[model samples]
Every structure is written in C-alpha cells, then in structure tokens.
Target: MAGVPEGPEAEMLAPNLAYQEGFGRVFLVCAAGRTGERMRDAPRERLGDTPEQERGIVRDEPGETNRIRPARLAAVEED
Candidate 1:
C-alpha cells in the first residue's frame, strides 16, 4: 500500500516488495487522518491475499479515494 511514511517504523518497504513480486499495483491508501500504526498495518494485512484479491482491493480503494474531492474542483465542475 502507498501510505506516506507517517512515523519512523512505518512499513514502506512492504509495498516495494509487493510491487517487485507483481502481486498487484501499488496500493495507495489515503492517509488523511490515519496514524502510523494503522497505515503500517493496512498493507501488512493484505500480504496474505492472492494476486487477484490484491488486485480487487487495490482497484476498489480508488473509488473511496475519489470521493474526497476538493471543494474548488467540485464547484468548477458544477459551473
């Protein structure tokens, strides 16, 4: 998962490993209000998934991510 490193021990390396192994695309979770522990744990939880499951998890995340649009962009689109 592509969580920004929030603390010193955050598990950024796992995503790089996942990418190298071709399990799925980089999982970019939104780190809006999450703590380092949660961010680190999220990717680790998915480590057990098959590639297909990983793909679905990664694919579905973006829909939730997309809902957090900027107000200015939303206003512009309305215009």
Candidate 2:
C-alpha cells in the first residue's frame, strides 16, 4: 500500500507507524515549500533525484539528439 501523508502532520506522525510486515512504502509528496526543504535529504538514496530533474529539456536537444543516433544508418549509402 502507498501511504502519502503531507506537511507537518505526516512528518510528525508517519514515522510512528513504523516499517514492519504490514506497512508498505510511505510516499510523502509534500508541497515544495519550506517544510519540503527541511525534509530534503532525509532519505536521499530512497528519494532519487529532485522532481526538477528531466522536467523542461526536450528530447530533441541538439546535444542529446546525436547520442542516440544509430551507427548503422551511416553505413547505408544512397544511390
């Protein structure tokens, strides 16, 4: 089960629930505010990267575009 408790209520109370057999992952998606800033890095490994990551940059970026290019395409010469 996915438990999502936000703000102070979740921060103060969520830990008390404890992670044993029954409790699944407690995913807290809080507002990106002061409270969220304080909670940052509480579980770095578990949270992965911030939500800002991979948000705006399009897949068609010139730099990133060629990285995925197929090498076999160049081998096919046109008539």
Candidate 3:
C-alpha cells in the first residue's frame, strides 16, 4: 500500500511515494496504535541503516508475517 505516487491517487499518496524513494521498498509497519506522525517518521529514521542492518530488518519481517498468517487464517476459518 506504499510506493511512488501514481495513477489517479498521486496527490493522496505523496508521503508514501517519498517514503518509497527514501527506502528501497514501501514503508511497511504496524500502525494499529500509532499516530500519523510516527508512521511517517519511522521509515525516515531507518534511512541511514547499513546494508547489514537493513538485511536484519528484512529477515525479521517475514518471520513476523509468517507467524501471523496461520493464526489469522485459523481465525477466519473458525468464523
């Protein structure tokens, strides 16, 4: 849901577009209880991350995602 501003929604997505350009990919994070400012600043904070540091971040995200997926699938299946 984040990337370069394009299509008819470019104006609305300007911030995310900037984020994508700053980072190698879209800014992905949990926003459940976060403010807009926090979300906007999170990726920027990591702008100076080294390749190894970013690799560590990248490696962790998928594990977190994988951990969530099955539980979510079970919850939906129960419903």
Candidate 4:
C-alpha cells in the first residue's frame, strides 16, 4: 500500500473497548465487574479505598495511580 506504515496494521479501538497487545497479537479483555473500582479507577465520587483493600493504585491518589489489575496484564506473550 502507498504511504501506509510498513508493518502490521495496528488496531485503533473504540471507547470502552478493553484490549492489550504483546508480541504481534492483541487480546481483548473484560473485567469481572466485582467489588472494586473499574480497571482504572473509581468514579469521581470514588469508593473510599481507605475503607477497603484496593485492588491496585488509585489514580485519585497523589502519585502514579495508574492502577492495573491481573486482567490488565494477563498472558503477556513476548515477541
């Protein structure tokens, strides 16, 4: 193809679509929707994690609160 990036076609996802890429393949992921925040963080009116054991970093916290769960890093197939 002309002027297209010379590599595998990288997929651009729609909003709220869960996915991860490793090596050359991408996998779609969905949370169990359990007793905690979303894969990223709580609602703006988030749950007071101080009131519970947090699954990962709370972005609302003071630091790199980019919390990631097992589903966020599952089955990391290396190149």
Name the best candidate (by lDDT).
Answer: 3
* Model 2 lowest lDDT segment of ten: 53-62
What 10-residue stretch in candidate 3 is worst by lDDT? 4-13
- Tens-digit lDDT track for model 1 on 25-59? 56567665788777767676677778788777678
Ranking by TM-score: 1, 3, 2, 4
TM-score per candidate, chains pooled: 0.58, 0.21, 0.54, 0.15
- What would the TM-score be for candidate 4 when compared with the true structure? 0.15
Cα misplacement distance, residue 7 of candidate 2 (Å): 38
**lDDT of every model, 2 decimals:** 0.67, 0.40, 0.67, 0.31
Candidate 4's residue-wise lDDT over 1-79, tens digit each? 6754432221223111222221112322233443333433323222333323333333234232234444345645431
| Tens digit per residue, CA lDDT, model 2, 1-79 | 3677677656645443442112244433322233553554343322343334323222224344454344435655441
Model 4 CA deviation exceeding 4 Å by range: 1-21, 34-38, 41-79
The alpha-carbon deviation from the true structure for residue 17 of candidate 2, after best TM-score superposition, in angstroms, is 25
How do all the candidates rank in terms of lDDT, highest first? Answer: 3, 1, 2, 4
Model 1 TM-score relative to the real fold: 0.58
- Residue-level error in angstroms, candidate 4, position 75: 31
Candidate 4 vs. truth: CA RMSD? Answer: 13.8
How far off is residue 9 in model 3, in Å? Answer: 7.5
